[model samples]
Target: MHNEPLAYRMRPKNIDEIAGQEEIIGKNTALYHLIKKGHVPSMLLYGEPGIGKTSLAHAIAGTSDLPFISLNATVSGKKEVEDVVAEARVTGKVLLFLDEIHRFNKLQQDTLLPHVEKGSIVLIGATTENPFHDVNPAIRSRCGEIKQLKRLEASDLLGVLHRALTDQERGLGKQSIRITEAQLLKIAEGVNGDARKALNVLESVVIASDEENGETIVEDWLVDNLIGRIGLFSDKKGSHFYNLLSALQKSIRGSDVNAAIYYLAHLLETGDLVAVNRRLLVIAYEDIGLAAPHIGAHVLAATEAAVRLGMPEARIPLANAVIEMCLASKSNSAYKAFDAAVRAINSGNTGDIPPHLRDTHYAGAAELGHVGYQYPHNTPIGSFGGWIDQQYLPDKVEGTEFYRPVQAGDEVKLAAIYERMKEMKKNKR
Candidate 1:
């Protein structure tokens, strides 16, 4: 066997060979067509580590038969980029794959913009960080597309493991090694959808088995020893953390208690109590909304308890909050209403405040026509007896309907109360 790492030896030779990322590289997909035509634009591939960003870039270059040049933005400087650009200018076709493109500073990224614009090189930038936040806008704008890769599914990882086992030319097929389907699945789960980690762990087991005995027969204990130290796949400050948070909220919104708790466990494993607390609060108010406004207060109290108690113990209250929010009646009316109002303001519908509703305590307020303000509490048609007819919003948006409550949980009662109040106001008018 060549001494190359299994991940390296098993790199896909073409787009068809790439595992996972079917959304991007599947037949008839935009990226698949781009590579098939051998005319890809400057692109950014973004996702968590070991999800095949580098592999896909190489596959594109290989399948297209384009000259491939690779650089790591973390180590390479402006000089390296300039050198690559110069070389690419000489060669009419070159696919420059820059790994960890987020590591490049503004000056370094800017250096490649013109070359990319001029078609000197078809840039394929790979990053684990979100390009919008980490990459220079100028460079991001020049990239024709940003492709997001997801964590590989267990089935896909299993396929990768099998390929390494049986591909005699490049893999360990020549060795007398045997791994059960169950053992392969165990390693796949342990690696958290990372193909590189899966392969490395598999390779480690094979080597250890070889050293111990000429024949390599993988066992549960051997795999356990190698994988026992591997922690949950998470980066506290990276896209993985945010993705988990999103999943948690969506699960709650979808009322999938199991999924919500699952993602909650992952966040707590990272000791990210604050993110969990904040996102739970948002879900309570945004997702749960007026359907169960009490849940918002309950979630706040739980969050407070979590903060005071801290992890291990904190997870209890957080879990309680998550379950309650998940089971609580769901509504987004409050959230949508706020967004609608914001849109109106942005669209220049913010007319002058009704004079009667304007501040009247100022010295010249009465003379400036701010005196018609109704004291609803003092009036006979006040809320004590019944709601008074009044214009609360600015004239431009006077009759705008924003808070349309759905017949969900407490919102049903709210809708009834609102209709009654509107009727009373209409009678006064």
Candidate 2:
């Protein structure tokens, strides 16, 4: 017990012992009632690593007094699952907590369905990836609504730290160690909302500190040193990677420069320049759009430079792009207009191309009534250059206005031009 990791030793024994995730485990919460009633159902827990998914599972088993068994999907296979099922049949039921359950292949995941459907196995799957995106639908269907555990708040982590320091049975309470509230807060906040990380850091600091006069004191500098370079929880293949990209784009769109750069730094840390670069370009064109149209070119150049430079150094250009994007005037009129056009096509509103608008480059185009195409370049009219009143869109959508520019940055001027063009077409008719 003394050799075990603090995180493992301090695992919550009941739902009441769990910290954070009040929404999921609060006394009034459905899950809390379910566990207290010993009605632990097959379900999936999805969230960032170190946020108590495994702890919650253990707590459920403890509170229910159900026979508990654990296996990691990454290492275990059909045979191991069969064994658990066999044991479950003898025990009437077993709480099987499967960690990294997304690693189970389709067939492996299928094996859990029947046992889970029957009463023999109460499946509690833990995954960092979004269960909807990564888990098999069959497994997901039996699990019911997937529960997402949020990252622990600093205050929640503070509670965890204090518990570990005072619990003599399973914690460092036996040691004559002293630490200040400020230093504890540092550990709680530094781990990026991971309770396990906070506990581990405290344990390391205690291990390194030398006892003097039967008292081991933790210092601020040592806490910082142990928590060096906080590793953010994200992987190139996980939903968290996409979430960071989404956050970066939203922050930039909302003109929050600080948040935008923060998300950018996290994305860069993943060493996935392709996802980062691609998402930045999308933000430039899709969010900034006609508002700061030139931003697309600038973002392209920055991303290109980032690809050439490669990490650590690549972050420089990426940072510049993120800042510029955050400050840029934002508009989604271009994308919205394109989406509208697509909606029209998707709804089967497409009509035949007017004969005059059809291609006339071939030799027999005139015979095929592909003539009468009023070339805009030859029949220029109005202040808008190369403007003509001939219909370009197919008949059903001929008069449909898709590119309705917004009153933002360059789009303001472009919108004015668009209105003038419409007016010119009306007058010509």
Candidate 3:
């Protein structure tokens, strides 16, 4: 048992023994009820890698004492799936754990539909990719539940490490290795919520330790040295990726240049140029909107340059863009106004286009009262330069104010001009 990797040897044999995902496996949770009743359904377990999707599937089968069959969709073909179905038929029912289910194409996924529907096979599919975007819709619909397993919390990972250290049959307990709580925590933190990675690093640290009188003492320095080799797994497709992206945008919006630059570097390290560019464009329009509208154009230019140049060199323009955005005055008035306008329209407040504001170029448009539209270009007001006091909105929304500009950055000048225009219009009225 010592020859096997610590992660594989310490696989939880029951639901109660599972380390993390309290939201999904805690008492009174849906998954908990399913396992307790021994009535496991077809479920799609989606989350980041090394977070125990396969282990949970095994635990579910073990709890029910049902026949369990495992397959990897990346390698399993039609014949392998047929064999599982045949075995299920003989056993009356079987728990089929298909890992990386997203790798299965449409036809491969379809093969399981009939058996799953017929109660011959209870499918427990696991995937890191989002099921909605990657899995076949048909197969997705058949899965009774789609439970999302979150990344294990730090404390939960610590418990897992402690368990491996004490379990004599399956873990390093036989080795008499002494490690401190703080040292264990270092391994937990370095893995970024991946228990398998934490266990592997712990095993390596123990194996490399110098033994004295059959007792191996794992010093902090030895753990630190081993940890340096294991890079933190940055899941570009998982929730962590979105969390980091959110942090970057919030940092820029909060005017923290250092934090914005740090997150930008992290994304660049992951080689997610497309996400970086998309997020920068969104931040410009959403966070720095109206206050510094010109930043949008500059952001686009930077994005273009980044895309053309690619990596190392691309980071220059991206860094410049991030710095500029972080230092600029932030506002969400434009975004808020658009959302408000959308809500009003969705609530059935969509008024008909005013006759004067309707299209007048097409033939017969004038017959429908589309004429008498005031051309602002032809009616310039004094000192206003090609501007005129005119009602552009429909009568129902004539006085509605959707855009309330703030007194920040370029919006200050815009607000002044808007107030001046309102005063001129009031006098004309």
Best by lDDT: 2
lDDT of 2 by residue, 1-429 (tens): 398999899999988999988998899899889888889888899998888999999988889999999999999988988888789889999999999988877767667678889868999999999888888788888887589999998999999999999999999898889899999998888898998899999999998887889999888789889998664776787888889888988899899999998998888888899988999998898999998899999999999999899978999998998898888888899899999999999999899989987887789999988878766788665565686677888878878988878898888898888898789889989
After superposition, which runs of candidate 3 have C-alpha atoms over 4 Å from their true positions? Answer: 229-231, 235-243, 250-262, 294-327, 332-386, 389-407
Q: lDDT score, residue 153, model 2?
A: 89
| Superposed Cα deviation of residue 423, candidate 2 (Å) | 1.2
List where candidate 2 sits over 4 angstroms from the true fold.
379-383
- Candidate 1's displacement at residue 348, Å, is 5.2
The C-alpha lDDT values of all candidates are 0.87, 0.88, 0.87
Residue 36 alpha-carbon offset, candidate 3, angstroms: 2.1
Candidate 3 on 373-403: residue-level lDDT in tens?
7778887767766887677877777877788
Residue-wise C-alpha lDDT for candidate 1, range 1-429, written one tens digit per residue: 487898899999999999988888899688798779877888999988888999999998889998899999989998998888788878875789999988878778678878888887888999999999988788788898999998888899999999999999988888878788999999998888889999999999998764346568887899999987463776898977998999999999999999999999999998888988998998998898999989989999999999999979998988998898889898999889889999989999899888888887679988898877666666564334534577889988987888888889999988888787777766767
TM-score of 2: 0.94
Query: In the order shown, what is each candidate's alpha-carbon RMSD?
Result: 3.7, 2.0, 4.7
TM-score for each of the candidates: 0.83, 0.94, 0.79
